[model samples]
Target: GRLLNALAATGNEKYLEGFGPPAPGYKHAPLNNTNVVRDMVDDETAGILVEPIQGEGGIRATTTQFLKDLRAICDEFGLLLFYDEIHTGFGRTGKMWGYEWSGVKPDVAAIAKGMGGGFPIGAFMATEKAAVGMVPGTHGSTYGGNPLATGVANAVLDELLKPGFIDDVAKKGEYLKGQLEGLVKRHPSVYTEQRGMGFLQGIQCAPAVPAGDMVNRLQSLGMLVPPAGENVVRIFPALIADKAALDEGIDILGKAAQSFEAAKAAE
Candidate 1:
């Protein structure tokens, strides 16, 4: 797969270790965040890579315990912790960085998505000790630190770090999850379950209902949700979204699921 290819190019040959696909009854499923990292990493490994909460991988949330274990393992082996918080940064997961929820910090991390607040931007931060060998000009992006991009990113961060901004995101995330859970309970025929942390949520629909079909239905209803690798629909609304907006969005999703079910029955 593309992921395997990309990883290979960056870090030499790597093997495919299967991961759990988000689906029916995943809430009770064993959390394997740390286990997977341990299985793959050893003394010679430089670092462990992870997404505290997987976005495109269907809003899958890594457990706090798993994160703690990863931190411990990394210390044990003198390995760096690298987080891909692209979709979970900028208070998207009710925190400035999703890794904070795990009470674990990474030596190096890449962040984007919410950092732009609709503008295009990306960044990678690292602890100097872990970046010991990354000399000047070792790696560069044509536009990585352009003045304009930096200015815009600064503005976005200014707003996000403002007092109560992240707290509001946390409140709204809980409220949104509450609403989605309600819908899941009310429409078990359509949604088998829900999983995610903070605003990065997913609704697992029937396996018979392809994720794309659900997204298209939601789009037709004037709402947009992204699909994941499995039969999961992702909800990555803006960080500033309020309860009212979240309620409306969830309502649209519920209706879309119902519509999909009706159409499926017809078929």
Candidate 2:
């Protein structure tokens, strides 16, 4: 449906043969990468869009090999590779960009979520050639590059580019993941497993226990996590969060899971 909508909006014949089944995990809703590129899009004209780390799609991290293959495929077809790293950029993924994990360079990339630390901002970065066709006035934004926003973004980038900031994000993310894994082990009935990478993590729980209830419970306990696809709780703490903050958040999450387990056991 999404691809169809995109194709319809573009009104380009390029999407005719660029159709592929869903990748491996979605066998029930098969969307192959090749079919997507070859049938639904014009091999030479259309661009390939992907989320390096799908923040809302259950925090699913794309496999390194899959990303590399996508890059290779895009290069072969003269297609642009675009990465939607809105939620994974600015050290959130323990790297400056989530695509770094796959060692793939996208022709175009979009980011926003973590750029302003909570302020509203959206950004798109592209290779010189990818943006070459865009003439001045072809696109303009009232706030896209406002001086104030630009200054803030510059500061954010400067801070993130510091030698140890991203490295710290990596270390803290590992710690958080380990803590969440332990919680899963201790509360097996409430959580099935831990998934995701960097500071983006999800706890897959039983469907009977609504993610809303968990979110409310965590909120009551002074913690906030988002609901991911299916019945999972997504955790995306600020990259600047430290060990103590992570521990506190994990404790709150563990308590919430235990409470859910107790309620389920009673039922």
Q: Locate the minimum summed-lDDT window of 10 residues in model 2.
A: 22-31
* lDDT (10s digit) by residue, model 1, range 118-150: 888887899989778889979887777888878
Q: Write the per-residue lDDT of candidate 2 for residues 58-156, one digit (tens) a residue.
A: 777777776777788788778888888887888888888988988889999988878877777788899999999889888877766888877788888
Against the correct fold, how does model 2 do in TM-score? 0.85
Worst 10-residue lDDT window for candidate 1 reads 20-29
TM-score per candidate: 0.85, 0.85
Error of 2 at 122 (Å): 1.2
Off by over 4 Å in 1: 1-36, 264-267
lDDT over C-alpha atoms for residue 238 of model 2? 78
Please report how far candidate 1 places residue 200 from its true position, in Å.
1.3
Model 1 clash pairs are: none
* Cα misplacement distance, residue 245 of candidate 1 (Å): 1.7
